[model samples]
Target: MSIDFGLIFARMPEILAAFWVTVWIWIVSNVLAVFLGFGVATLRRYGPLWLDLLLRLLVEIIRGTPFLVQLFLLYFGGPFIGLSLDPIPAGLLGMTVYSTAYYSEIFRAGYNAIPVGHIEAAECVGLTRGQIIRRILVPEMTMLVLPQCVNMAILMMKETAILSIITVPELTLVVGAIGSQQYAFVEAMLLLALFYWFLVELSGFLGRIAEARLSKFRFAHS
Candidate 1:
């Protein structure tokens, strides 16, 4: 059977609107995940034993749960706890919480890879803790972890597609609605796939650029 470009083009406005929602949700949740993950990892790495254990427990609990279950708990369960959130904010919160758990693991791995001896050496040279972190730790970890972080970002972007399950009206929901209403499942789904494909390609291209720039020190050493 021939494909119908006309049907797809006719629905472009709604599709584009939904796509933009997906884009923004991905951006917001990713930013939150990266920062929160780093913060939690740092605290767990250097804070007291109690704090470390607590963070570890939290991470494990989050990781053990399914993403959809978490989303439902936040979106549907919020009202029961007197924390009524709109679909978008609830979805954002769920995504942020879920991604943070994984990003924290990535960060923890990066942090652990940096030798304590290097930090000690910096300290012996009379460098302040803050100076040591800024000059030594940050750059080294960025180089070691950029690739994994890029992969996590891509994964987080794909996870945003699931936000549609909560009526967040992202790409999947929009396309699915159009398909159901117009009996154009093939065309609607084809366009949806193309939209996600373009995003994945764009993200991969930019990630490669970032990885190359950030890992220049490694390249130079080799």
Candidate 2:
């Protein structure tokens, strides 16, 4: 069958609009996830044992389930529990919760990788726990785990397509609608792939820049 490049070009506006939605959701979700994950990791490390166990259990539950199922439960099953949410909110909530679990683990690993002597030295120097975390631990841990975090961000970007299943009007959903309406399945699919490819490539490029800058900062501080 012949491909129709014109059809893809014609739908560029809609595709780009949807692409922006995906980007917005991904950014918001991952930002919240990272901060919340860091808090979770910190608590697990230094908080009381019961709280750590509870957070650990929750993390494992989220990580163990499929994201799609999580989304469905939030958007569809939520009404039964008086917790209804609109599509975008549900998608955002689901994505944040799902990513927080993995991000917590990544930060947890970063915490473990820090030398104990560093903390001891900070203690000897009279830096409060909060001061040490802000002045030293956060920066060091960020440098150590940044590459992994970038990988996770890229994976999360791709997973935004799954939100389309919940009718979130993201890139994949818009493209699928176009395909269905115009019987241009191949063109639609190709365009969808192209949009995602661009997003993933752009994310990788930015991630590399971030890693390089963070590396320089880490060394300068060292």
Going through the candidates in the order shown, the clash numbers are 0, 0
Which segments of model 1 are wrong by more than 4 Å? Answer: 219-222
lDDT (Cα, tens digit) per residue for candidate 2, span 1-222: 988767766788887898889999999999999999999999999999999999999999999999999998999999999998989999999999999999999999999988888889999999999999998799889899999999999999999999999999998999889887778888889878987899799999999999987787663333
Residue 87, model 1: lDDT of 85
Scored by lDDT, the top model is 2
Clashing pairs in 2: none
Q: What TM-score goes with each of the models?
A: 0.93, 0.95
| Candidate 1 Cα deviation (angstroms), residue 172 | 0.8
Candidate 1 all-Cα RMSD:
1.9
